[model samples]
Target: MDEYVQLLADLTEAGALGEEWRGAFERAPRSAFIPDTVWAPDDDAPTGYERVTKADAPDAWWSLVNTDGVVVTQVDDGRADGPGIATSSASMPSLVATMLRHLDVRDGHKVLDVGTGTGWTSALLCGRLGDDRVTTVEVDPAIAAEAALRLAAAGFAPERVVGDGLAGWSCAAPYDRIHSTAAVRRVPSAWIEQTRPGGIIVTPWGTPYANAGLLHLMVGRPGEPSHGRFVANVSFMWMRAQRPHAVVEPVGVSDHRGPSAMDPELALEDVNAAFAIGLRVPGVRYEHVWDDADPSGTYRMQLSDGAGSWASVRHTAWDAEDAVHQSGARRLWDEITSARLWWLEEGKPDLHRFGVTIALDGAQSVWLDDSGNPVA
Candidate 1:
C-alpha cells in the first residue's frame, strides 16, 4: 500500500497526471472505492479473469488496486461469476488520466460525467470543482447504489442519477464539460443538446469491425454541430445500448468454398488495417482465429455481416497458398483487401490522423488529411 501511494505520486511528479488533477486524484484515492473482489483482466485467459479478493488474497488485491491495471468489477453484465466476459471495471490509472487530460477540466465549471462506474471519477471531480458542480449518470441501479454510498462515505456528495447515460441527464442541461467513460459509435444528439456551445465532449469511439479510437469534439454553436479528430487509439467496451448484435460462426454449405486472391499476410501485417476497414466496410464484423492445438497446422480469418454475408480465408504454415471462400452477396475478403489497398493509397494514415464530423442533419462523415474529403 505504501509503495502504491508513492507510485501514484510518482505519476503526478512525472507530469502524467495534470497539475489540476493530481490533487483531486490524491484526495479520492482509487483504493477507497474499489470492491473487495475483482476479476483481473486477462485477454489470453478463456474465461478472462483470475479473481483477486481482499479476504482471500489481501496482498494481491492491494497490489492490483495500487498498480496500473484494470480491476474488473462485473462479469457478463453482473452474471457469470467466473469471468465468462468482463462487462465493467475500474480502468487503469493511465487511461483514466489520459481521458481526463483530454477533458481539460477547470475550476468552477459544471461537468456532466457519463457512466458513473465506481464513482471514483465523480469523487475526483468533486475534489476539484466541489460536489455541487459535478453530476454523474449511471445505468445500473445496484452499482449506482454502491458507488453512491462509497462517494458519500469518502466525504464527496455529487449528484448521482440511476438512469441511461445516453440521455445525458437532461436536468443538468447546458453543461460546460461532458465526459463519457463508455465508448460510442456516434456522438449522441442529447450530448450535443445538453452541452453548451464550445463545450468539449471526450470519449473513445469505435466501429463494428474494430473497437478503438478517441473522438474529441469541440462543439460549435447551433446550426454548426460538432466535429473533431481522434487524438489516440484506445479499445473500450461499447456503450450498452449501442452494442452490436452478436455474430455467429458461418456453417459451410460446400459452395461457400472458393479460390484465394490476395495473401492473407498482406491484410494481417498492418495494425491499423482494421480501423481503416471499419470506415469502409459498414455493418461488417471480422474475427481472427489461431489454433495452436489444431493438427492441420492452419489459421483463419472470418468475416460476417448482418445480411447473411460471410467469408473465410485459411492459411497453412506448411503450404504456399492460402485458401479463400465466399458464400454471400458480399465478397468479405475482397472488401477487406480493397479497404487495405485504399488505406495504402492514402499513405496508410495513422488512426490519429483520421477525423470525423457530425453534421447538422446528423450525418457522420469520416475523413483523412482534410474534413472535406470523406473516406466513405
Candidate 2:
C-alpha cells in the first residue's frame, strides 16, 4: 500500500495522475491486474513473473504497474504461449487519468465505459461513482474475465459485460457520460442513441489521411448526429471491424508510361498539395518517399493499390539536364495542385480551422470556415 501511494505521488507530479485520481490508484493495486510475465521498458530486458511460486513479490510487480505504455497480457484468445502480440492491454495510467479528467465524472453521474481493457479504468470509475453506477463492456471474453477478477480483487467491481463495445450497453441507457478507450473513425449511432441529450462522448477520430485527434462531441437529439470540435492529438488502434485493409506498394514503375515531369522543387510542392487535397477528398491514399543521391534522386508517390503512379525529376550537378516522368492518375495530381493553389490564394489558412460534421445519413464532411461559412 505504501508503494502504491508513492507511485501515485510520482504519477501526480508528472501530471499523469491527478489528486482526485489518487483514491482510485490506492484502491486498485495495478499489480493484481497485470500478469506475471510483463514487458518493462525500464529494465534492460523483459521480466517474467512466477505467479505460482512467489506470487507476493510486491515490489517486482508494483514497479511495472507504474511504467508508461500499455501492458500486453493476453493474445489470440489467451491461447498463445509466451508474450503474443498485444491484441489488447491496460492503457497507460497517465492516458487513463487524462481521459477521466476530460470526462469530468461527478459523484452521482451514471457513466458507460467502453472497451473495458483489464478493468483498471472500470475500477477507477467505480471508485469515483460507486460500482453499481458504472457499466463497462469488452469485446474479448477472456480479457473481460481477467478484468473482472482484477476489479473484484480491488473491492470495486462494476457491471462488466463481454460484447462489442461499439454497440454499447444499452441496458444502462441515458448515461450522463459515455467515453470510449479505443479510437473510432466514425462515431457510432448507438453511442449517441444511448447517451442523454446533454451528455458528452469523448473519442479519438480522424480521416483516412490524417492522424487522429481527440473529439469531444455533445450528444444531440435521439436520431441526429452529434457535433464536436477537435480537442487534442492522440493515437489508438481502430475498432476491429473498422480497421482498414493493409496497404500494398505499387509494382513495375519502370514499365509505366507518362509525360516528362517537372523539377524536384515542383514535385515536392505537388506531394504537399496531395496531402492537402486528401483533407478535402477523404479516402485518397498516397505515400511520398524522398531519396538522396547527389543531384539525381527519385521522388516516388504510390497510391493505396499496388499501382505504380509517380512523378520523378532528375538533374546533374552542373544543372546541365533534367528528365521527368509523370504517370498514373494525372487528374488526381491536378486536383492536389489546384487545392494548393486555393490555399496560397487565401493566405494559407491553418489546418486547425478545418472542422468535422457528421450527418444523420452517416456521411461525414469536413468544412473550412470563412466568416462562419464553409469555404470547401
Candidate 3:
C-alpha cells in the first residue's frame, strides 16, 4: 500500500478516523491538496520554515505530504519576501479526521467550512455531503484561488468565497454545521446567527495564553447561548483577526521581585493547567526561554498581559524556589499562582472537562463540567 493509504489505516487503528467518514477521506487524499512548494522547519532561519519545492526534493516533499503531519502551504499570507511564519497549512490528517468525527454530519446536512487553506477539508465535505451542501470561506485571496483550483482538479467544487471567516458566509445562512480550521479567541456571534438551532459548530478555541483546544458547541435557538465542552487538545494557527502579538523581550524596569513557591512547569509544560489558568488570566501570553549562556541549565518563564503588565520567574535545574519579578500594572505572577491554586483546588480537571458558553451578545464564559458552573 502507498503512504497515503498507510496514513488512513493508521488513523483508523488509532480511532481518529470513523468508518462513516472513511470514504470521504479516501476521496480527498492529502497529497492532492498539498502545494508543490511548501515550507518545512529550519532551525537556522528566523522564520520557522525554509521553502521546499517538489521539483527540487520530490521524495522528501512526497514523504512530508503523505505523512499525518501538517503541510505549511503559505507563509506571511503570501506576501512578497515576507517573513516566513506559516499563515496557512493543510492540517494533520488525524486531526482532520477527528474534527470530522466530532462534526457528526448526516445526510442532507449543510456545512460551512471556515479557513479553506488547501481546500482538502472542503473536498472531503463535498464528497460526503455533496457539492451543493458545502460552502467554504477563506480570508486570503491567493490562498483561496489556489484551493479552488485544487478542489476543481480533484473533481470536487464547493461554493468557495474569499473573505474573513470570522464574519462567516451569511448568504448561505442557517447551516447545519460550521467548522473552522483556524483557532479563535472568541466565537463570533455571526456563526451562531448563521447556524440553525441544535447545529454543531466545531472550532479550535483558546485564549492568548494557549493557542487552543478543539471545541464542539451545540447551537441553541437565536438569542440563546451556545455551549460546548473541549473535546481534544489541538494547536492551530490563530485566525488572522484573533492572532496574538508575537512574544517580545519585556521592557521597563522591574516593579517588584520576590521568591515564588509555584513551579514554572505548571504554566509552561502542563497543557491542562495552562488552559485552566488562561480562563482565569485573560489576555496573558507566555514564553519559556532557556538561558544558553549559563553553564548551569536554567530558564525564565515569562508572562505578559499584552498591556503594560509583565512577570518573570527564573527556574534552575536544582528545583530551588524560583525568583519572580513583576512589572507594570498587574502582578501577573501573583494572578497565575492564584489561578494555579484554583486549578489545583478544583482537582486539576483535564481540558476535556472544560466548556464554554457564548451568550447572544458574544460574551463568552468558561466553565468546568457544566455551563451553569462558570469558571471563576
- Top-TM-score structure, candidate number: 3
Q: What does the lDDT come to for candidate 3?
A: 0.88
TM-score of each: 0.92, 0.71, 0.94
Every candidate's CA RMSD? 2.4, 6.4, 2.0
| Candidate 3: pairs in clash | none
Stretch of 10 with least lDDT, candidate 3: 314-323
Error of 1 at 272 (Å): 2.7
Q: Candidate 3 at residue 178, lDDT?
A: 99
Each candidate's number of clashing pairs is 0, 2, 0
* Deviation from native of the Cα of residue 106 in model 2, angstroms: 2.1
Weakest 10 consecutive residues of candidate 2 by summed lDDT: 45-54
Candidate 3 wrongly placed segments (more than 4 Å): 80-83, 290-292, 295-298, 317-322
Error of 1 at 102 (Å): 1.0
lDDT by residue (tens digit), candidate 3, 1-376:
2988989999999999988989998888888888999999998988878788999999989988989898888888888588777888989989999999999999999999999999999999998999999999999888899999999999998999999999999999879999999999999989989999999999999999876699999998766788999999999999999998765656657568778867777665588888888999889888878767873465788888778888888776324444787888889988988998999899989999999998878888889998878988
Q: Total clashes, candidate 1?
A: 0
List pairs with backbone clashes in candidate 1. Answer: none
Per-residue alpha-carbon lDDT of candidate 1 for residues 1-376, written as tens digits (9 for 90 to 100) = 5766787777777667877788888889999899888887666878867778999999888888888888888788877554387777888887888888888887778999998988988898899999999999989887898898899889999988999898899897789899888888888888888888899989889888877888888888888968888887787777899886566665655435555666666765554777887888887887777678983555777778878888778765312343777767888878888988898898888888888888887777888867888897
* Best model number under lDDT: 3
Q: Could you tell which candidate, 1 or 3, scores higher by lDDT?
A: 3
